[model samples]
Target: MMRRLSGLLLSLCLFPVPAFAQSKPCTVSDHPEYTNKIKEFTTESFFSTELVDHLPLSSCVPPPDAFLHHIIGAPDTLDYTKDINAYFRLLASKSPRVKVWSIGTSEEGREMLVAAVSDEANFAKLDRYKEITARLADPRGLSEAEAQKLIAEGKPMYWADGSIHSPETGAPEMLMELAYRLAVEDTPFIQKIRNDSIILITPIVEVDGHDRMVDIYLQHKKHPDKPPYPLIWWGHYVSHDNNRDNLGVTLALSRNMLKTYLEFHPTVMHDLHESVPYLYIMTGTGPYNAWLDPIVISEWQEMAYHEIEEMTKRGVIGVWTHGFYDGWAPNYLLSIANNHNSIGRFYETFGNGGADTRVRTLRPSETSREWYRPNPPLPKVKWSARDNINMQQSAILFGMNNVASNGQKFLSNFYLKSKRAVAKARTEGPVAWVFPADDSRPAEQASLLNLFVLQGVEVHRTERELRLRATESGRDPDAHKEKSAEMSAEKSAGKSPDDAKSKEEKKPAETVIRAGSYVVRMDQPYSRMADMVLDKQYYNVSDPRPYDDTGWTLGALRNVKRRAHAQSRQNRCSRRHRRPGQNLPHPAQYRQHARDFAFPPRFRSHGSRGRFLRSRRPEI
Candidate 1:
């Protein structure tokens, strides 16, 4: 018997169990410890008897022989795509709460997936819920009754994206486990979460980079002189700077991900990332932009504080909020959420690990106080992929849980916040920036219009001439003012200035804005984004500093004319009102005007009668 036992032990040791071993359904027995924890979590009085009775007895715990179990034993820095694929497949096959949709393909032709997870009721009416969120984000046509009804039944939509930057390896891997637990776990706490929230997760934003990084890491694993870190590029062409493409959407990955974001119009959005080695004592820490839409900012801070409290309650270690990442910078994808009146935040988890090795030992230092304040006493900091994953997982879960718990308030806030943005635009002049559709540089103006469309700014083509005071049209009023004085002097002398005007006139001419202008209205939900991109913004003019890109007015740089409606216009003839035979300037006269100024003389010449109307918004 001893000889037989020895032989069996040797055989078992030599051949370990496969990652996906048994075909049995996963249950609480696989992870009994979590079941006990769940019980402790739900013991609160708020978790009523009815709720407990409805909870599933068997938690959807992966079997001890499953892929998740195997990964726990291995290092956290392996190629997680295979694990993600396996896990998602399992969820799709068995979990009724989870539904995965392919949003679009990446630049390198990798499939991009967005998983929509909620309770069965919410999942069934997902389209209806999406429409509700959309209307909340843009309440232009929503009736008061419909809006209130939708708010009453609304659940906060939490959107989380993992690993847009390839170096931030923890998020993509951690999200897989997070998705699995949230889908399969049948505890009361989890049930409340699923029922009260709609969770949208994009596992890997930069799919091509993720695959390439994994392949590179595997190839370099056995090399003797292998680098300490993986030689991975996050973006296809732009690499690390790919995150800066939100406003322009220059990359395919950004474009597709943004399209998904616009489609869902989530209540809260979190973009996960990994920080540099040993900078702070926290697992995750970043500050929010101070210059976001004020109403939206208030709502975001409320959610953020709630998240911090939730993290503390959930026993997450070393978390901080509000000071580092500002929402004013429109370049990042998270800023899309900010611009659209959603509570958006960026989470940076500490990361410094190799495919198989833990890198450096990070401890609390004076420098740590500069970036993040520890919660009471700081926790021990040991650098490892496991630690990175835990922190990111904590941030994602607690953040979403806070929003889910207060879904009704969040839903109302979304609509009200947009209304506040519109009100703010009205209070702060100008009411609109009008750019003539017909300009000497029609192609250049057209290019700028396309950029505006990409950035989600609402553009309207004027039907008729919008008559505003020339002094308030954002042009140099001094020039027009001087011309007015000259006209007065000419009138006082009783001379007809029109006939006696010098050939080389130094005086500015009085100008009237024509029809066919593209109006960027300030009283819109996305007014902040519109203003930031189109208006002339000063850099570091005050004590409080801007996070990034202090001075950026793409419209101004492109020499596009912007007629500012500083004061409300008296006449609102926006459509075709010009008489056919009116004294419109000749096409040659427009060409001469274009040449006189340094404007691009690219306007199409119609005829000698100047049927072609070239217009541009004057520079501020």
Candidate 2:
């Protein structure tokens, strides 16, 4: 009997039952209508609740369903933003691994919150990790050994925000469930992510809009026959146009998000949106933004392809990329990360705003299989909010798993990209961009400078006047020709070439940059952002058509007088003289300047307490 038992044990060890097989089946479905609709798209294993609840969980922390009183993605049910915030606070209070804090208040007075999920040990060293990322983000004085040491001790912070558009109601719901899984699940996958990376989630980006959307959705559910009531405005002053305010930083939501980004320096920023086939991870088609680091462009594909591969491996279909959107624009909501040397990506899922199941018939073009989209969506599939939630959650999990497993790679690349940005300023031209203090439009100039400061760009005011030679300054085109003509005339007059050269050296084109000018040097880590915003952008005309605006030259748009100072060979001004002057005034000082400007009637009515300049808000 002992020998037989030993043999059976050995056989069991060789081929153990799967985790799901050993756990109890998920028999509870709060909304079978929504749950049943996705059955044709994927199996139970794809649903996040099914997979997460099967794992060992902390009894102290209740799952989202227990707290929300219904499973997320249930039909005709939408939790208000207040309830969501309350649930996040509850998670933070219950779990040592989770912490929630308000970033700022929305325009409509709703609190915008962010939740940080990680292992308890990581939480203990949270400040240390934050410092490490900050150093890596601007590696100027950092040494090779120091960087390697920090990389060994650092954890990549992955940021995922949802529902910026508000009408795409599935993201915030899915995010709430995602936070619960990360906080409570004790499975290997969850533990690995908790141990290796810090997950930061903003459940609802547009808080006011989320509640409005929920109200509209519920009202529409009441009268199925009547056409849905139109939400004339999603934000206080804008609708879907809120996503276009990243570069402009006009909206309160944009400023709050930028503040969070500057503080955390996350390695990845993932924004979730809805309205696509089944799912589309963003690897924008062509005519990519010229100002973004090449590595960032590659990183987009790296993350997108990794998500596609992982999802495909799990038997999920319609996980595609490299279509629909072009990456030529830098004013997108996610462009903040892309400009700051971080991987910024987004997801577009399929949902009809509510939990009701709807059958979607695909055209032949969408149904046909392609290289980017291996297994196309079915010709007709019963889609619901639950289906949207499952696919989004699964894709997000795979993405987090990738980042967690390759934490070192992500950290190292982040450091490398910042290092490259600093080096480019030295080797390449355009050492700095100078925004003059004597511009006719002082308000606009100050507002533009304030925008850079808000975006975390290093801004300094010159203490004294600067006399710089226009060696490579693109201004004064006739100056160079006139000098050449003078030299030619001297040579024609039988003067030696050396004499002409000496005469030319004495009278080179000189440009004076007055005192109090704002200087944005390219030697810093976020110099790419400064360059992209201040420098001209020439989109490649030969590439595919752009999906959005081709140019967002802030200086040109704002009518701010700026000059690019190239590295000069003959300028007498020492490096110390050309160095950045005193740091620009505090953000509040700029806000004071912003208030004095004359804004449009619509924006002026919103009052002076807006984030930045109310009058000069970009219309884009």
lDDT for 117 in candidate 1 is 75
Error at 228, model 2, angstroms:
2.0
Model 1, 1-620: lDDT tens per residue? 99999556434422213333336765643344433433433223221122111223234434312544444213534555544654555565456677777777877677777787788799888888877777776666567788899898777899888788886676777677677667766666677779899998888888777777776666666664875455545657677878877776667777677667767888877888777432111121113333355666676566556656655565454556544554455677777787778876677766653334343444554125433444522334335554555556655666666678778888888888776666654577667767775666554565565555554555665655654545656543124556778778878999875645663364344445676666666666666777767765444455356556555567667766666566555445333222111222234444445554443322222122211122223222
How many clashes show up in model 2?
1
TM-score of each: 0.74, 0.82
Stretches of model 1 off by over 4 angstroms after superposition: 1-28, 32-69, 80-86, 143-145, 228-232, 276-291, 313-316, 353-359, 362-372, 376-380, 471-511, 541-547, 570-620
The TM-score between candidate 2 and the true structure equals: 0.82
- Which candidate number has the best TM-score? 2
Q: What C-alpha lDDT does candidate 2 achieve relative to the native structure?
A: 0.75
Root-mean-square deviation of each candidate, in angstroms? 11.3, 12.0
Error in Å for residue 531 of model 2: 0.9
Candidate that scores best on lDDT: 2
Cα distance off (Å), candidate 2, residue 537: 1.7
Model 1 clash number: 16
